[model samples]
Target: MGKKRLKHRSLFLLGGQPGSGKTSLRSAIAEETQGNVIVIDNDTFKQQHPNFDELVKLYEKDVVKHITPYSNRMTEALINRLSDQGYNLVIEGTGRTTDVPIQTATMLQSKGYETKMYVMAVPKIESYLGTIERYETMYADDPMTARATSKQAHDIVVKNLPTNLETLHKTGLFSDIRLYDRKGTKLYSSIETPAISPKPTLERELNRKVLGKEIQPTLQRIEGKMVQNQHQGTPEFQAIHQKLESLQLPPPPSSNTPKIPGL
Candidate 1:
């Protein structure tokens, strides 16, 4: 396959406490900047993982990862699309964001677009609790929200396991398998589903370094809260709101347009 040329956008990252009303601020900023903006949140695309609440009812349910929309693919796609369009961005997500921000900064900087962070420094325990609260409310309204929340929370669990084990015994390929070696110590791997056996030598090594799942989600929740605009009625907020209102979107192209004659 041939390599495709990538386009970039200047994103203004807005991360803080979960349920901090980041969406409200995003709306305000979009209105203010008069530049196109959209969230990379769960609503960006549809996710399929039915019955997460039922699954969570089982033992060991951690909830943040279950609902977050900032998956690896979605993140990369948003960055690439933004780069191409060169539009102003106001991203909203939980705190423990991965290399996307740094990578995006370096990339846009090279292209002459500036980037800034609005980090919310707060307590981790408080942040984690906030995420749970947001999802509980979100799931009540959106089915997709429920599934994403379950997936994110499971991600937290997989990241919080021991790394020193030389070997992991597997009675089955996925979660149904028994994971302890004869020593009786439990093993941890990303294969929550029965897709792959955790007993593979290389796979075991990869899973070990990932222990520490709770940290990022906790950070995200706090980040979400701090960045919220409680007073959208403020002058600055209203300015942005008005600018957004002034934008004139183009109509969709007509279906009668002719296609190329040759393939």
Candidate 2:
């Protein structure tokens, strides 16, 4: 008789904006799988920091340069370690860029795991509002911090969503891909449908983000409330907002473009 073969487990990559309901879906999937899945969330590591709340405030302003690198390193290390042990992983992240998730997916695929990708397909404004609402309710003691973090999340969703979808389609890394709206509705599925451009509303939202104007009214409203109470908005918040507005992002690359290297 031939030697017995070990069946490899699956890797589920759950991608979404900060408040696009990844957590809830992850929980549901975990329960459905009967605790057979291990979830690796970038924010989980951030929360492990002694100054987690404070780091959330800092992340609003300097996430890219100051916060993300540390979290990314930790996340990468954890994923590698768990994959080597042959655990089924439900890896979740913002999917702000195609690079990390693609790389992670490719690595796990090489390790004999089947990979699947799911992106939250909620509207940017709705996701932004959800962030604010979640933080306001969950962290009522720190409205200012909530506003800041929500704004940061809003920006990320606006800037990355279209490209993220396009990239996922182009890479063809996953055996299956899906898009779920905020209500857990499956709006699209690669297994059942053809590729399509992001909705026009999404494109407009991206334009607004690149122009740095989408979150201004919300910021102004929050700042107005704070100033009414004789409290001031943090200088970092103002500075980062201004910087984002002044910067210009390049056009999303064509789908026909080659997949990113090391993916």
Candidate 3:
């Protein structure tokens, strides 16, 4: 039997402090990989807000909290669309502001693709505090007008703060902050890909095991009938063979493929 050839594309999420050389490294990787590395940053969608200034501050103040969830959905859609178009994605963002990376990793892992986390860092330790200070004086006069920029700054803080998030977990100023960061050197992303143990839908489990990972094990009855007629000339077999050929499944030993034991 021919081995199952799996063409797997992985997504690596580069997350870290602003001063961290994430952008430079991401750019270098993308250039080296040519079209394979796709970096999606917030700057792409942020311009869409008509009153971007107000939105930025509101985002920082935690006033428009629901926007975070919507952003995650929008990102997922963008990643999905990009994957379908054949470019492997590298999602880069200030994770402090939202749960987009967790959501994306969960979604991609479920679909059988691999996802990884990257932690980039730079030498600046107190930059975030200074950033918050700048936002305070810069937007002091206009409560409603300074939101968009505030939100952007807030995102940077949320993702890059010196305070430990897991230990701080929602203490006063931090309610919906990121879960954790700060374990070790670069590439030590706390983010983990959960086990891909799909709930037993007797049908799917059975199909996957028998059809050998690539073919629909459940469709063995159909696949067997199709392969049996791949060479023998007949319209019904020809149609079946055509359908099977398009799927490009591996040739099997028998029409009635054996079932995987556990499924």
Candidate 4:
């Protein structure tokens, strides 16, 4: 008898701190894949906001205030909708604490998708400096705002990035995982082998810490304001909502069922 060939859709989780070159790497992968990958990038939603350019020009502070919450929600909703549609995905994000990517990969795996994770291992200080330089160059018209945003992003990346890479390596959720340097050089790839046992206790503790410390507070703040502004009827949110409505996603599953956590 011939060997059975296993086939499944792919989900690539590109993990890195801000300015660590996730977007660039994602673009490269998309091109290599011949545009077959659907990107679920955090910044894409922000860029799609109706007033994004205008807000960046006039009141930079309001840009963050309005775009942050809506972008987060839209990204998550789009991931769910697209994954359900069986599109191959390339998701880019900070992966601040590893929980987000691990949870996301697990959800896709449960849906019979194959998962790969690429963790970018850039020095925290270098990433911070790079962010300032990149943003200053990209947003030359608003250097002050660019520097402020870069600095704020730097703090979060410095605080969470070290542990994130370590935790992600430990998750075992991905069928294949690779570490890459800032220049897109692959550092290490996990060996192809049989199913590995999960360190559930460690994962649970990490999830608890991440949720209690980072995610929950941020979600609470965003959810509270989302109730108030109703997303300010942002185009990004409206488009995602329309997609979700078209998908007709069912009501929440039971507690035991795995789902993607709000990042």
Q: For each candidate, give its TM-score against the true structure.
A: 0.39, 0.63, 0.41, 0.61
1 versus 4: better TM-score goes to: 4
| Model 1, runs deviating above 4 Å | 1-9, 46-71, 120-129, 142-263
lDDT of residue 156 for candidate 2: 67
Compute the lDDT for candidate 2.
Answer: 0.62
List per-prediction Cα lDDT, in the order shown. 0.40, 0.62, 0.43, 0.59
For residues 46-156, what per-residue lDDT tens digits would candidate 2 score against the true structure?
545556567667665344345556777888888888888888888887777888778888899999988887777665654664564455443346543333354665676
Candidate 3's C-alpha runs over 4 A off are 1-6, 18-21, 50-73, 95-100, 124-126, 129-263
lDDT of 1: 0.40
Question: What ranking emerges by TM-score with the best candidate at the front?
Answer: 2, 4, 3, 1
Cα lDDT tens digits, model 4, 131-225, are 53454344444542442344565567656665665566676677676666656676556654223322232233223322223223333333344
Q: After superposition, how far is residue 148 of candidate 3 from its true place, in Å?
A: 8.0
Which lDDT tens digits does candidate 3 get at residues 153-235? Answer: 53455333333323222222221221122323222223231221111221121122223233323233443533443423533
lDDT of model 1 at residue 217? 47
Shift of residue 70 alpha carbon in model 2, Å = 3.7
Considering lDDT, which of the candidate structures 2 and 4 is the better prediction for this target? Answer: 2
